[model samples]
Target chain A: MTATLAIGPYNQSERPALEESFNAHVVADPSEAAGMDPAARSTIKAIAYKGHLPFGGAEMDLFPNLGLVANYGVGYDAIDVDAANARNIRVTNTPDVLNDDVADLAIAMWISQGREMRQAEAWVRDGKWASDGAYRLNRKVSGGKVGIMGMGRIGRDIADRLAAFKTDVHYHARSEKQTPGWTYHADPVALANAVDFLFVALVGGSATEKYVSKEVIAALGKDGVVINISRGSTIDEDALLDALEIGAIAGAGLDVFVGEPDLNPRFLALDNVVLQPHQGSGTVETRAAMAKLQRDNVAAHLAGGDLLTPVN
Target chain B: MTATLAIGPYNQSERPALEESFNAHVVADPSEAAGMDPAARSTIKAIAYKGHLPFGGAEMDLFPNLGLVANYGVGYDAIDVDAANARNIRVTNTPDVLNDDVADLAIAMWISQGREMRQAEAWVRDGKWASDGAYRLNRKVSGGKVGIMGMGRIGRDIADRLAAFKTDVHYHARSEKQTPGWTYHADPVALANAVDFLFVALVGGSATEKYVSKEVIAALGKDGVVINISRGSTIDEDALLDALEIGAIAGAGLDVFVGEPDLNPRFLALDNVVLQPHQGSGTVETRAAMAKLQRDNVAAHLAGGDLLTPVN
Candidate 1:
């Protein structure tokens, strides 16, 4: 029986790399592990994991000999870290490698939403430019006030990029950071009110679930735009949907949702919102880096070295 | 008779400001001036012009007392400068004010095309994410090589913005510019070949017509993306269409087209392109500034002062 188990529907390009490094057993999800022979499950010492499915103690119990679970993404919200800790199982996630791609997407979405590039493109493709005379003038994005929620590594990266565009950067973090010139808001609602564009860059997990609440969304105002590159759980999706539907907020550029891939159907009808399939770090370069980090963590655990990026 | 003629269809918001500033006669186009009574035509000393219709010596002849043509846009290509010079007419354009908006759009378009953001948006909106799983990974835009075809003010602004993203900024100009640290290629093809993204920001006129020629486009290679915020005539549109059709180049983000407003229908069919209706400088703030600048130039000319932004 293979000592390693790789889970999730990884693509052809990613599969070869995992196969080369480990004698592995591949499964689509945790349910598949339950169906495996008892001896085969007992043999699994490490799990290479991806996807947003919850992996709790029940799944860990199925693999009696499981030692480590290496997550493919920066966010380890789906991995039950507490359960892993209780079971004396180690957990690690790929981080930092995807910061540039996520930051780029956040900035791109902000510009796209502000400039109405999606609708502008459709207007040209539909022959409206010739018949319609001129495309409607949009709002300027640069030199505007920008607020970043959760001044983590990704948040700082986004703020850095926005600073280059000459935007007045504001942020809300757990505590005051040493960032010079950037205004720090103790409250998220205050940060939202102060900015023309608000970017959600908080981490995932229960602590940050619905961190951007109804009050925060409302404070952003009618001229404000929201750009979320963080997990969908960071925002109160119902409040966001209502704000978008009635024009309480000018627009939203969402890369994540509360139940994404299976995101709310209401988002499908919005012309003001630029929707992306939770692809903040879905770039060839970034994904490759993330995969490498995930494998490195697993390799370190197997070789009796420190876990590369431990969560538990 | 009015001292100024505000030509082209001015919006309600803009028309009031012009009327408040000047004793102005508003006409739709050059042909409308021809239809006006001889007294009205002869009385027109300054024309506050907008639109892409040809305004030449023939049009200038109608306004026997015309001293100034204060163009509402930076590109005064539609107004023949030589014709204005032959008739001893001074031409002024609103420049510098619209640079930030245009540069913003160029950067937005480059990021959009490189990330395949249009398709990514549709994939999420059309419920493909749930059915098709994750959207395919796209190319990362930041930290790539970017070429500026013309290193003028707007181009320099674009380079400055791209530099923040850590891109290698290379440029081609008639002569070497004072841009320290940025690579300068004497030849356009060489510049194109050296970059992943090419931005066209040259001034519009016959001298620069087809400046981004077929050779330059080909040299950009298959992984290269072209972003044009300059005038339609700056690029060889036919060659561009062919390259896009055959996948000879990766993609294009075109805000201007040959004979646009009436751009080629072939562009509509291509998924690799992101089309914009030449709204590079079309922003509420920027347009207002442009209108104010145009009015200022005319006011200066009417008061027997030097033209604010004279073309010839």
Candidate 2:
């Protein structure tokens, strides 16, 4: 069995691992194929790309050549999954493996932003302490309210972590859940109104798109915070900006966005928000685990077994 | 019997609860005496200040009329204890009442900073989804090393929180402690080298001052984080900057500073550090509890019983 592999801009451990598992010829870079002649391009049977795909830009044409394009993460919005589905090409994503890391990050943001840890450290780094007064305290976290949107694996994981802190857990999902110790609300607004901190863990696409809008933002009145770990489309940027500008909400911690990297200019101007390059499941251990799963997924697809995380 | 009373900056519910226990007058603004005329200054016999002393800037003439000064919180740096002692004035501070809140904040900072929660949330709020690609995974918290500079009550509380997380706990103190599940090192440099995260919970006075210096920072090396819930003097500012700039130490979460509100400018530039406004015991419950303790301390002193938290 002949296997042709197109390599994406990955962190490099994938190449040797996949090669060891199958007779694979690796295309080291996906961009190099743009200049390759038709005969050269015809030689490759399938490809995998990593790192980041430029937003609102052309989908790298490498997907058409592959029988399976196994993404190393849960979010595959960057890849044209619909286009691949139209062509009957199999699109796979590695999920459930990165839940702990994501949940850890979520809880961390809630505490850092709420407690003003960044600002606290600045005082020591500055020389004013040699001449001045006592340290000022920030907000509280232990008995605060925590609301999770889209209560899947990562959301549930975050709830479990919060349990140790004794925080009250509330979640908003499409339908009510029978999960104990969880107060479920069918609407996001009610959840927003009740929670001091709101988390987004819902999936992307039409159903969850624009779910956390102006109404939800309004519900999360003053001193409320929004944390989004799902797709950027889950939140309405303009609505968030309006809430932030007027101080209707305390602050926000976001991991996903509708149009990232070239993020909304409004977020950059606000000091109340914590910013990062979209790297939620971007840990070394988790990424390696994700890559292994992607490999298993591709091999299974080839072996006539069902895909681990099928898009359909 | 002729009686005199002194209370710290506590609210009505906290300090006034001792009305029947002793003759106490709880002043609303103890710092206002700084600007008073001679007659008004002479009228008040005692005071209670909470972070109200313009310590390093303008010293208030609080001693001439004051027979005793009772501080609200554990730290009495705001009160001129030497000056009060010279005038035969007794100084008292509420110490043990604040251990739990400080400890809770320390653990919160540890988990939040380690996981990079702030950066993750910012990615989502910025609308990175429509314009960009994948989510980045952050660092983990469980099984990491947690070092303590001061193995006092708050430090012990932090150690207690880590038990559930399964973190390896290490502490550096002047003397060895019999704390369970804890490894104590007599040398700060040795402890810094052995741990990934260090918590500062030492005393505020002379002996423990400037304890964490360039040598200790270097010992920790890159990827090490220090959290200061103790006095700002525990860490040497210049050394911390050098460590942070060169990546010798990964980051720090500071609640206390050497100069305070007039914090150092260097910390403002770094992305790795987390800052707070010196609020270890700043929660509503903790503050209220501290206020009640302060009232009780003053009442006990007036009643001729044992002082709650007296300076030896």
Candidate 3:
């Protein structure tokens, strides 16, 4: 039997399981994926993919027998679904498994920003607390109004968690959801204006790129904060940086960033913001579950069964 | 008329309010009190004390006409209550007002520790994320068992918040109350052993000193995390440091410490711990409420009205 091809920088522990289950051949990314012997590539029927590095029809054309692409995360924006659909390639993703982890992080970042947890921790570590009597008072987070940009699964999870924080959940979606007590705004700018915190939980990819526009950030005025757990593409980076620099918005607690890992250096200089290295769903339990689900989908494809979590 | 004496490092915003409310005489601390004239000392009938500085018989006796010690925080451990009782001096504390802020910090710290928020933020801030890949996977916080050491107002609030995070709430108090669906541990060690996270919210005083003892710390095995939002005296700090150093416990997120401001050097050296500068109630809204409550108690006393939140 030929092998299942795995791509992207997977954890070392995941490699063994991938190989043992499907006789998988792993490579760094698409760059190394090219120029594989035609015979080896032709035999590969399923691809277990990780990371968002565009896997369009051009990449799919290399593997003649490829029937399925199992993505390692909730978002499959990197996979050109339209291209795959034309070529009759099925797509599966790992979702719901990471919702708890992502929501936990979103709430953590929001609370950290409001309470000055970052600077306060530094004061304790750097002996400033010993010298200075008390840290300066910060504004409260609980009992504030929050605007969620999207009302999808992850957005709902974040809203549910923040609901426990005693925040009024106002939201913007394509249309209003059946969220009884939560106020819905048709326009994103209106939602931003109504809330003290703007929590971005929109889907990633080109369609929603810069969805959290300059107007929305502006509506979230001098006392408003922005907390993004969704993809960085959802927000306009330049506008956010300008607002943060000029104090047009109060502060931010960001996880995902545009061109992440190599994000804008301007974010590093801001004293008011709390920045994290895109670890929203980066937890041991959630990652393991995501990996297992990804493999399960691949296994289903090999066995000619239905995909576990098919995106398309 | 004689003025109400305010002591400890009150905020700049609070100073004016204090002066406006009672013609308040502000002093840094007790160190500055010893050399005051007898007439001035006698005039200070009520001391709006704000810190844990052993306001005992000696300090109370300094003011010959001292009738009240209104504490600026929920904990009145600093006030020698027995001594105050003997001298017929009433004690009042600012409570309920700070519960939301304290609980929010506890949950924030717990989630931050579980998700490695501190280290992850550092990875972004220090340009390590650009150099490295994603932050190393951390354990998930939601769906874990959390043991709250006390079931008081603040503890209840923490439990309520964590409940929303999908945690199973197990708590230990003097006697089990009417909390349905939550496990009640009679002993601290059992509570520590039963949960992955041990949250300290016990009342602060000699009775509860070292309540989270060496044995309890030991019971909270290698994977256990400790989150303290209560007073420093609730837990044995030395045992906590030793456990964190040797990995007897996974990590700690501490808001309070013994001899706070100047905590043990051992804590500063540990990377596994998240040290906060006692900012549980340090927010603009909450602190203002606390100050107003403290003043309200003083005002009630002057009006010969009922004390709002009296201790003794």
Candidate 4:
């Protein structure tokens, strides 16, 4: 029997991996493939969705007839695990494969801000260095304090990178950690006050919404820097701006945002912040590996084996 | 017996140090105190002169009676060393103390560019990270190659910083080095081609005029970055602009310029560089330490012991 498979928002990079593991491919936009419209999505027997469609979308109803849904990456926010469970449809996400890449990007962001890298590049590329001189007023990165928000795999990796700088690492989490050389604070506020640089690596959604608010930002104080590789909603944007304008905090480095594409105009004016067009897991090596893992998950589910990375 | 002293641009920071060492303090702007104008020079019995007048306007002939002239810092470009030698005035320069501080700024610039730091800061502080949704873009620093233009103490310290990054250190010097972990390249062009990043730590003078010319810049190609913390005059400014415009080289970090405080407007438009106000050794800690060292050198000279850091 030929099993029908619905492809999600993932690009062609995952094509080979998908073909290798699945029998029949239904390459449609997730919205269309998940029977977005009652009449359109009834054709698919199983689904493989990616970045499109939130977990509570109309497409989730199709899971009743679907056997499995393989997510493209570790963040399975777009797929509804609860709905899939009720319908007996298994859901899986690619997690372990992306840890290193995300961690590497996170570290790169931290160093980039600590060193004022892009400005350095502009200095030389603009010939200001040759004309006026370079690094005449640069800052130091060694012996700086690094605070990690959310103690997890990626956060630990960032700490590893900080070791080279001889930096002190502090972590803020719901629970305290017993890790040596790492000081644990009860929350982000206490942690922000004690560190020179703060990094956010926790999960997204309501539980963490606006966790870094005015109180937390004020604790960071002047000369303090923040880096967010976690969800943007965790931070209070308005509070952060107030801190930056009044010198309550020094600067920040971010890879995630709230409204996104429709970014805030005020952010465009600040030189203390660094901007990137989100591509954390976009590395050639990491993206390919993630695609492969998703493929493997699909193969395992079809072969009557347990899903590799189930989204409980 | 009265003694005269020439102080060239020596601010309050250097005053205390000089007072501790010298038995008599007769301060003259080096340009005027050195008797630059025969008619303006005072026929003092004995005096010490500073290297030069502020902005090169002072007449050096203010104090003709000076027996000893102590150089403040490593570079003696403002002092007429030949004239001092003719007068049998012993000249001393404070060197070793400031090497580590300058080197720290240089390496910090290097790593900042390699990591694209300024952009990262802009992303977060500007709140773009929160508004842009998801994004990840930063350069890696761990395994890149490092090249030094001059193999001096500062260059050595820079190489030491590279140890953590696991970089292969290469240097272009007048002669080969016996230092470990550094391979010497006799020519600047060869060195530029052999490394991912090139750092200029060479002295500025006739012998090293425009050493980093268009030829050397071309050799670095598109992927290589150049960092100059030594002196602006050591590089060919015109050549650097051309290279940057054509993308012949990736980027640069500069702390010194040919004619500073009057930066080129051309550089103001580029987005690939970092600019500073030439405060490499501006840190409070480093500056104080530098002042202390100069003072010690002056004290040793006054006591008739050999100068601590004599240039000749």
Best by DockQ: 3
Span of 10 residues, lowest total lDDT, candidate 1 chain A: A16-25
Q: What is the DockQ of candidate 3?
A: 0.88
Tell me the tens digit of each residue's lDDT in model 2 across A1-312.
344464565555777777777666565454555555555555544455454453112333532455666676787765676667665667777788888667766766676676565554444455444455333545677667889988887788777767666678899877877676689988888999899899888877666779888899899899899877777888987999889888999998776655656677787778777665556666777788888888888788777789888765
Candidate number with the higher lDDT (1 or 3): 3
- Comparing to the true complex, what docking class would candidate 4 get? incorrect
Model 4 clash count equals: 72
Please, what are the lDDT tens digits per residue for candidate 3 over residues B217-286?
9999999999998888888899999999999999999999998878999998888888899999999899
* Candidate 3 wrong stretches, greater than 4 Å: A1-3
Q: Judging by TM-score, tell me the better candidate of 1 and 2.
A: 1
Q: How many clashes does the backbone of model 2 have?
A: 54
Docking model 1 quality class = high
Error of 2 at B219 (Å): 4.3
Candidates in descending DockQ order: 3, 1, 2, 4
The deviation in Å at residue B161 for candidate 3 is 0.3
lDDT of each: 0.90, 0.69, 0.91, 0.66
Tens digit of per-residue lDDT, candidate 4, span B205-300 = 667889998889888889778888777778898888778777888788777767664566665665555555455565545556656665555556
- Residue pairs with backbone atoms closer than 3 Å in model 1 (clashes): none
Highest lDDT among the candidates is held by which one? 3
Q: What is the TM-score of each candidate against the true structure?
A: 0.98, 0.73, 0.98, 0.70
- Candidate 1 global lDDT: 0.90
lDDT, ranked from best to worst? 3, 1, 2, 4
